[model samples]
Target chain A: MGTINVSREYSVKEKMFLPAIIQGMIITLKRFIQGFIFHKKYTIMYPEERRNYSQRFRGMHFISVDENKVENCTACFLCETVCPAECIHIVAEERDSASNPYGVRKEKKPLSFDIEVLRCCFCGFCEEACPKDAIKLSRNYELSILSRQEGIYDLNHLKREVKGRG
Target chain B: MSSYEISKSENYLNYCSDKIRPLPVTGPDAKPLPKMTLDGQVVEFVPGDTIMQVAERAKVASRIPRYCYHPGLSIAGTCRMCTVEVEKAPKLMTACSTPATDGMVVRTRSEKVLKSRSGVVDCLLASHPLDCPVCDKAGECELQDYDYEYGPSRSSFVDEKRVFPKSSTRKLSDKIVLNMNRCVACERCVRFTDEVTKTNDLVMLNRGWKKELTVGDEDKGLYNDYQGCLSDFCPVGALTWSDFRFQKRVWFLRGNASICDRCAKGCNIEVHSEKEIIYRFVPIYNPKVNAHWICDEGRLSYKMVTNSHRVIAPLLEVAGHGPTATSWETLIPVTASLLKNSSRALLVLGTDSTMEECENLRKFFSKFVQNGEIRYFNGTGITTSSENKALDHLLRQNDKTPNTKGVESLGLKPLDVAGVNGFDTVILFRSGRAGIPSVAAAKNLILWGVWSDEEVRAQKNVRALLPGLATQEKSGTFMNCDGILQSFKKAVEHRGYGLDVTRIIEKF
Candidate 1:
């Protein structure tokens, strides 16, 4: 009502530009000095110093067994059929004796099993599709081979690894 | 001066992009342009050419192993033995189905690709019945070779194996046998039925472990004229002919390239024989002609050559008496005397005669016999239907003879059966008595044919019935309806002393 002049009001404080600029520059300088002078590298050489994997880590594969050391697989082709790349191959045989009834006597056994490591995308589909918990991805990823012919994991090789792990 | 300035302006205006430069206009009557090349080799290929196809054209040694990718049939990428390493691709690709691009770098035997292929061979052998000793396709099978090169030393399967019924034991029809145990299921036979024959008679049935092949239950069954193609198309010992099943291993038989003699089609075929006995006939690929198949009738026509019923020697009959076995020397004199003494001599040529024999006979009779009259006769009736008619119609023509058109091509006119007058002497060629009623009516009938049908030989006035050689016993050319001249070699000699018709006529 009194027609107060509200336009362009200016306030002033004591100038401290030099100290504020110095503080910012000091923080930058501290980082630069720490990077060059006092830096102790934390990067680990991968093959020479292996990293600890998580409990659920999936890497190279192995077959699992029950307490009796008998193979847990029923020779069901679920893993082989469900593999998108068709890398998993299993030869199944009947393990049942003539005496048992209820059709339970017929147990499927893996006569010859192989996983083409070269063809594997490591998608964990074979492990996921195994109904008997026979095939599992382990925490070992050293699957390199001198020749391509040696990359195909055969039944004997798989059985030995699985037995050692179990 | 003004024209030069205008041309310069035009050239400046035409320059837009380097890639879009117009090709120089050659004269209209120019010769064919030279083919382009890559890496000092000619680059010639159509669209959808596979890496293997390009490698073949370039004459590059490709190590891709294929079980199902036969050039004669549609591509079935089932067996993964042909894995190849491609530049910039994450995993190895199958060379059979992988298209060749303008600058694609394909490595057939790279370490990664070899590993993948070896893995495939190992996997393929996991469930494969290792019955090579007893398996019919043992020596020739591709799986056996791939395993020898890239497979594991021993099978890991320790349990009682899954046993499928052997296809050799299962009879699908009178013509086909199915041995399921040895099938790699490359689907070549299935693809052949679906693509080339278009009959859809065979089908892959069941799923997963229980998969098998079956034919329809219709009365015709797998009785398509191209049924023998399945046996040839089978890479494994799955589909075999009942006629050839357990008879002889394929390795035992030596294959000779021959043409089918069942019809005027003259389909290219391979005659598999041993000890001069033809055991089987399979089709050979001729793109301009029979693509990859021949009629079942043509396949079985080999039997006619080796059948025990075939006449093995020349037989001569005394006047009005039953035929007596005679030497060629005795028959030659009888035939020459009959031709020379008769007032009117008639030479009735059969359709099975080769072009050489027909032409030679025409000339021989012209010199020796009076008036030298000759007529064409065959067991199958001639029809006016076009040669390119539907397959069913063509098969029903009943023209069992192979060289009707060959004889026709040799300038022999079809005899007007209705206008034939009685002749004093007649010499019959190789056909049985099916087409000629007038020839039988002739006075002195000197029958020089393979064998007499019971009715024709019993006719009165027949003087001499001589058994001549069948088609297999002679080598000559047959010009098919399409004018393709196919030459067939003599498969074997007749058991007795019967001279080839060409030689007999030449001697006369």
Candidate 2:
């Protein structure tokens, strides 16, 4: 692979400082007019205004729960299998006989479900692969954290209540 | 390699039922071979042939779907999946139980047959958990394959499905795990336990929608020697072998046909491996041998090959380090010198040794250890062919080693513990099937075959350990219990430091 990048030759007039300076000023003037004259804003006004996302927008993932507050996941591992980034890890165990009212219908339960979101590609494949509507990528895209450890979401973090892909 | 095979018997039962029902041969009394037209192809079949059998003979392009119609098991055509449209017949008939008459036109893939099959799949899937992702049988599940081929786009049942509370995640035996929710009530496992092993360990309780499979005796859960076959024949994710459950997916495995060496039965098996790591051993259909069923001991025998303690590397008895793993270059010259120095060398070939390996050893020793006395050793207690008999009606034999008869046929004497005394250097050669003999009389003992560190440590005055390939890792021929010669190619590459007989001999 030879470098073709060096072959492009700029005309003497365009290479001179004036043309480049004018192009830079034009971008700045357009942005200034849009912000001040038209009152248009590119950045969100945090703590006040929130951006609405489409239903299909893939973002932070959460597991859904049924009316009884029991998780919908039977630990079938479809999400883990379909996850392209290999961010999800799960360990399954049989539900305890004493507490399991659903019986063999919900026999298997994920003992621990962890998702290292940093490694996740936000692909929504897990959402599509899940037989039960348990794992879903929510519309809330604000996934920043203070530390790297917080980016790895556990079952507890995933089980928190979220409404309608939010 | 595919879901249909994992769920179906990899080999159709080749049990020739002719011996059991010996009809009269050529004469006016003898019945002519019946012919049937399956999918427009006419073929001749035996007098009492099922539609599926006729279809097989005709080499029909479309395979009739089946759930409880294992060729190895007695026919219980309850699944309604194999229903086919027979010309002049009013309704669809199950090909499994329906016998084919001469000139019968069977359409396996007609629209009517396909529609009925789709309806059968819907009924079977109504209560099914549809949990294929976590299922060990996902890739090879018969239900999954049939559903993809002929099932309705979605289930119609609106009501909640029935659940067997205690049946899911049930341990039928130490080897088998039963998930009743995944079961489609095919009753194949129940029949297998009843007719095949004759253990009667599994029984189906209740009726209709409330049916459940439970152990015959609650106290004893699946106490059969052939419990591994349940997992092998199950058409769904219901019955799974505990040894292979959740270890690896079925599609990811690479199967190589090999023979089991746990016993003299020489059960043919397919080594299911992924990345050279064996997942499990499933019996391949050999009507002459195992016939689609492998004992749990033979099925679990792959663990021995994959064991961490197996002596893969050549070990030398270092002065301070005990048996230390050393390269062949370092140990080969030393072993050669030991043979040269010893005035009288005795070679003890294990009964488990293949015919070719034994021949190579006999020739190699006669040339190398010129003053050596060669003897074959059968470590599994039984001394001769007269003592070797069937331990069970099935595959197992009294002689545990696979090739006791093979070595005996070589005109080698059995090791008489008292007669073989005061040898200078004794070489114990085996393929890990024979027992380690008490060769205490020998001044120097060289351990060969698949020896572990623990075994080498137990023996005294052992000079070196020449790690050799197990039966699965090498190409050789073993004479089975029935005096049947079985030649097997190397299934998987030798994962450890072990070498075959020829390779080890060349090093000498």
Candidate 3:
């Protein structure tokens, strides 16, 4: 548990440090030649051009909607149960009989569904646990917000039209 | 009051009965109990039990799948989900209907039996709506249980499921909602209404593919008083209790054993609660008390404990502000001064008070109110144990309060016809079971034990209010209408500022 200090004499090559600096300069020159001379671009303009990520990359969350813009989520609570961060909160209520179009299948709907984006670990367990394939993790990773309240997503924000994982 | 006097009594008979099997004793004539082999284990069963019951007695019923078979209901082996292979029988037999014989051998998990169960699930799921996400019984449904155990991962039939449009949104009673498409056609609810309640209010309408459940008389609807029990035994989400329809998912509740204080029957119940909030009360199986069923009144009486209007904080009546919330520090001394200043005080104990509570109140008031007339009031309309009778054939009692007999056993007499007229101060204490009595005579009034804000506002000359725990949140003993003693522990923590009897007494 005690600290030990050992001293050693430096060799001439180690103390001069000229060859070490030259070796580092050669590595940097190789990368500069590949980028400046060969024109192999390593960075892209974020707003104009975007890099493609794998389809399985989990980022923001969205609820899938049907043709009539109705969300497929039945407020099953599978997402809330499987969430490790416990960020998902849902309040379920029975759908109005007069307005329900899908009979008994979608008889219950979420009165309020909220997700604290800041608290979510994005482990993708919610996507795996969902039975109706309603809740999904999309590939849109830009999640920065100006206000603390904007980090919390409501049902209306989640039900926006998401096109092909974007 | 000492801590020993307020110690919560636990009913250890049921809680500690796990993992200990009873020894099979012989009769006086020296005949051993009947034995059967269920899934390689030798089990001793009663004389006239089915093979399914024998498997249940062996604690190996989980290996067998079931839809129509419920232990509380009568046998109707129509589902064929519980089919088992017999050693020497010609064909597979339904375990629910086949009686167990001596040395009978049965295999519940054989390949042939599993294939049969899988086929049964297929047939049952063919017409099922597959709407478990929206169903209230999703987590605890028996049909879903059997389907997961022995069913196909993917179905072959691609045709559309038949839908009963009218019966999909059927209302059997104000307490029950029906959705026929979700039913597995097990006929458990129909038989429950017929055999248990004996009401014959429900019946199956059609045959085979068109089979549907409906009230016997369409015009009359369901007339049974025990309609809540229908939702309990339903294997599917066909019938649901309206009170718990969309309140919470079943998996989120944490259950604790408690007694129903709605009546004197002392029905053992499991309080399903989450975050100190009670979602519903379900009956725990106790053959000595309520057997697998509770009346609608007792099942729904838990709302009184969580009512928003209940006075949860200690209150002191200011000169002009009326009964306003105040801390225990200020209210207790102010209350002690009020009782000390009054020349004569009358203490009224509600019959709803527990045995230990009544004793503590008697000892606490004896020091100050020397000439105080102490009396027990049961405003439930019955005066004595002889007058308390059964209101129905089941658990309902004519005397509404739970512990009239227990209070009377403490040698406390009933309130006089003259009431508390001459006393300068009147102290009334109840645990929410007894009715309010006449407090018009006294100049100074004190209320205790779970009163509502509206109730306090209605009463005049109220000096102080002390909120006390509800029965579910407190431990107490009751002498039921049958003269049987029952004790219960606190099921949930008190969410309000209410204190126990011992804690309240210590403040003084």
Better of 1 and 2 by DockQ: 2
Best by TM-score: 3
Measured by DockQ, the strongest candidate is 3
Per-model TM against the reference: 0.65, 0.83, 0.89
Ranked candidates, highest DockQ first = 3, 2, 1
The positional error of residue B407 in candidate 2, measured at the CA in angstroms, is: 2.0
Task: Rank candidates by TM-score, best first.
Answer: 3, 2, 1
**TM-score for chain A in each prediction:** 0.63, 0.86, 0.80
> What DockQ does each candidate score versus the true complex, computed on alpha carbons?
0.01, 0.25, 0.60
Which DockQ-derived CAPRI band holds candidate 1? Answer: incorrect
lDDT of every predicted structure (CA atoms): 0.65, 0.82, 0.85
Q: Give the alpha carbon lDDT tens digit for every residue of A58-94 in model 3.
A: 9999999988898889998989998999999999898
Q: Which residue runs does candidate 2 get wrong by more than 4 Å?
A: A1-122, A132-166, B1-32, B219-221
TM-score of 3: 0.89
Off by over 4 Å in 1: A1-166, B1-44, B58-63, B165-168, B217-220, B319-321, B383-390, B393-398, B431-438, B452-462, B465-469, B491-495
For residues A19-103, what per-residue lDDT tens digits would candidate 2 score against the true structure?
8899899999999999999999899987598887677889888999887888888777778877889999887766776898876
